[model samples]
Target: MPIYDYRCLECKKRFDVFMTYAEYGNKTVVCKHCNSTKVTRKIGRIRIAKSEESRLENFSDPSSLEGLEDDPVALGKMMRKMSGELGEEMPEEFDEVVNRLEAGQSPDDIEKDMPELGDDLSTGGMGGMGGGLDEDF
Candidate 1:
């Protein structure tokens, strides 16, 4: 048996139904709140699993990031999305930079404020994966 979500048309409330696959269409769904038979099935969000390769591939499309070099906010948004997909821990400074970008701060201004950002986040030496991305990656 599985639970299904539904909303009552008359009472405008939501409820759940439990039925076997064979009894789905054959069952009479009624609202628990008001005994309303006029209920509509509600589709919940569905999640799908994907490979890491496929996820990182999305960021490799240069066309999708057109003019990103000129827009800090857009760059920050993209970076955030990429980080989520990467599912790896990033440094606090990385978060700070992204936050600054999202705040509409120009890259030059952020860099000036955190002069060591480049040298510290350099690919050759990430704060030990705890601070930045690995060079090999």
Candidate 2:
């Protein structure tokens, strides 16, 4: 199926019509706004789709981090792209971190304000029991 864009010469209104291969040439196109038959078909731009593997590979490339260290907003957007490529549901804290980064906050400042978001705290170092899970359970 292909979508065709048309602009009515009478009302000067533009609209889109989705048509199949069989009906593409046989049917008459009409303007949706004014029901005008004097419409001109337009050439629309084509779209391309990329594979998930290609998107993930782009995310993993080191070049993706270029200039990110100095730009907090770019770093946040990069983190979003990374999460999208991984196809996993990021935690709520991850969104907060990204939001703060986009708001021009440094990672060190964010860590100081929210210590639970620290690297060591992400593991079993902070809230977990004194002993390993295996020893308790």
Candidate 3:
């Protein structure tokens, strides 16, 4: 099945039509809101998928770690992107830590608040964050 996006000319609203390959050109699309036949197919956003090896390589690149220790916002963004690339649900603590980092909270303060964060994780040489996330992870 294919999802076709359309914009109604008369109502100026967008809608989608689901169809099989055989019924695509043979079927007529109607505006879900206005029931108008005057509609035009519109291109939609595109999403790209990468292999797991490639995603891991991107995270392993040393350049990606530049200034992340000093900049909490960038660190938070990196963490969020990593999580998204992994395409899975993260724990509540992960979300809280990322949100705090993005909100300009010092990593040291976050570490003090969340003492359960273990020291087993490695930071890949991006430490010196005032004994915060860098020291443990």
Candidate 4:
């Protein structure tokens, strides 16, 4: 079910109703105030609003990265913004990587020592491994 917004022409009452997508545009919306059936469909703000998932998807699209390699600052800022929004603290390894890159250190000099952080369950690492087979059987 999708939420549809409608405005009453007679009373100018705006309201949301949950209905199927097919029925949304065709359904007659009535005003709650004066019981007027003359209602108009309002353009929803969400129609153009990109969700967090959609934004992430857009960023990850390879086709969108045409000339991003030439701008290192932009890349760093984007990474930092993504990290902040994702509630992920930059690992010490990442700090080292950034520092090394800034200090003219080669990619080979930057050792990968990313320590696993945070609750494993919350991070969705290892889960659903076992069952109470002894008790059930």
Clashes of each: 0, 0, 0, 0
The residue-by-residue lDDT of candidate 2 on 2-113, one tens digit each, is: 8888879998767999999899879999899999889999765433465778767886777877888788889988887776665555554677788899899987788898
Whose lDDT is higher: candidate 2's or candidate 3's? 3
Give the TM-score (vs. native) of candidate 1: 0.53
| Model 2: residue 128 alpha-carbon error in angstroms | 12
Sequence-dependent TM-score of model 4: 0.32
Best-matching candidate per lDDT? 1
Error of 2 at 31 (Å): 48
Tens-digit lDDT track of model 4 for 32-83: 7788998877764322354678657646866655543454445445545554
Of candidate 3, the 10-residue stretch with the lowest lDDT total is: 124-133
Q: Give the alpha carbon lDDT tens digit for every residue of 1-137 in model 1.
A: 89999989998777899999999999999899999899999876444477989878988877888888799999999888887787765665677888999999998898789877766666543344434545643
Error of 1 at 9 (Å): 49
> Between 1 and 4, whose lDDT is larger?
1
TM-score for each predicted model, relative to the true structure: 0.53, 0.48, 0.49, 0.32
**TM-score computed on alpha carbons, candidate 3:** 0.49
- The clash tally of candidate 4 reads 0
Q: What's the lDDT for residue 94 in model 3?
A: 77
Give the alpha-carbon lDDT of every model. 0.80, 0.74, 0.76, 0.54
RMSD of each: 12.4, 14.3, 11.9, 17.8
Query: What tens digits encode model 3's per-residue C-alpha lDDT throughout 1-137?
Result: 88898889998777889999999889988999999999999865344587888767778878888888899999999988987777655554677889999998878888788765544233321222222333433
Kindly state the number of residue pairs that clash in model 2.
0
